[model samples]
Target: MRRAAYWLFPLIAAAVAIFIVIFMIQINPSAPHMNDGTDGEESDTSPQITEQSGSWLDRFSISEEKGYFYPVNEVSLKLTDGGTATVAAHYRLTVPLKSSYELFCVKEELKKSELPYFMRKEGETMTLFVDSNDQNRLVSLVTKLKTYQIKATVSPYTEEK
Candidate 1:
């Protein structure tokens, strides 16, 4: 009985989580397959691309007020072609692992800050993906994780002599 309890608890928790997700999805306004201009608004902004359009760059409409607002630490792109509209939002984050840091601590810290994050494997120390759109939140997360001498850097720039 003791051995069975170890597996049973996790299964129950997973089931509850799944149900909650389903419930949230049902109430969500922008759930999948519901954004086909069914809300009585014209779909002018969500125009389609055609072969006659020539270059894709010409179709891009970007402005300061109604500019394409992309989420930080996230990638979301909306593309239209002919009679179909596609929305793709994907998450990709990586933080270099310079020193030893416990996975549990990182997780707890993210949770405390109310950020969405997922860890693939503890063995993969160099990759930590935290889902967030707010720039300040992302900055705060980096600051909180600075328990040691960890610095985010890009490729070294070469200067002309």
Candidate 2:
């Protein structure tokens, strides 16, 4: 009985360790298929905008006079080849009065451009900057126009300078 118990103890511990390892693998299988493969697909990727099918816009009061900021708004990208892509708007703001704001908007058009000073695009993301001068320009420009709509698209990439 003593010898039997001694062997059973190690067997129980080994079984428990095996069970834990199996449970962990079952819970989180580290398989490559789990990834969406965006890294490889990004080279040929184009901008796409999600279609607004159910009219959720009606629920929210989307107005330029409301002095609201629409963060990460979706804008449809119109490609030169007569195709459309759905891209998220990094930031959209309608300034009713002069105000300081910090936001991000994704601009697909800027990505297609070669201008290094204004915009930068990498992979499937883009980043844009609205400095103090840009904010002032926005305030001045919107004041003159009775109604204005400003949509900014930004990339989510760090410039490699």
Candidate 3:
């Protein structure tokens, strides 16, 4: 009985080990081929991720831009309040934007707020144009933009003839 007990335990263990090995092999059939006839060197199966110091948008694309004043898009002044006043500024991204969805979301919010602003994508930057005779309205709009982590300064407001 003792002999049978010892043999049974080892046999169960061996069976379990064999089952685990077989399961692992079935799950991952591709084994690292080392010194195969095709090549005498081992293949690299590790993942490679190259990272650079810039905005996540830069990860989608790269530019030789040094400062924050890179023109992202083109802007045209359109006033909902029937004013020709346009505020042009080099709107810089203060935070790492998650995605272009953030821009769309902000645009939707601005539309709901009835603020006269238009954003157009030129290359990588986005252009923001605000048309309001009352500078206070523009200031309030800019202040509201801060909630979405958007920061911009007053630049030369030009009118295209």
Best by lDDT: 3
Query: Over the stretch 34-122, how does candidate 3's per-residue lDDT look in tens digits?
Result: 33235666544432333433544663443324322456586476549886766544222222234587667657756876766665666
lDDT of 1 by residue, 1-161 (tens): 98899999999999999999999988874623434466888655423444365453443432223434443475467666678665343333346554455455666776798777654556645556765445556666667667744443222222249
Q: Which is the better candidate, 1 or 2, if ranked by lDDT?
A: 1
Q: Scored by Cα lDDT, where does model 1 land? A: 0.57
TM-score rank order: 3, 1, 2
What's the lDDT for all of these models? Answer: 0.57, 0.42, 0.59
Candidate 1 ranges with C-alpha deviation above 4 Å: 1-93, 97-100, 121-126, 151-161
Task: Measure candidate 2: CA RMSD.
Answer: 19.5
Candidate 3: stretches off by over 4 Å: 1-98
121-145 in candidate 2: lDDT tens per residue?
4564443443332433434433433
Q: Give the Å shift of residue 93 in candidate 3.
A: 14
User: Which candidate number would show the highest TM-score if scored against the true structure?
Assistant: 3
Considering TM-score, which of the candidate structures 1 and 3 is the better prediction for this target?
A: 3
- Please tell me which model should have the higher lDDT, number 1 or number 3: 3
How accurate locally is residue 85 in candidate 2, as Cα lDDT from 0 to 100?
64
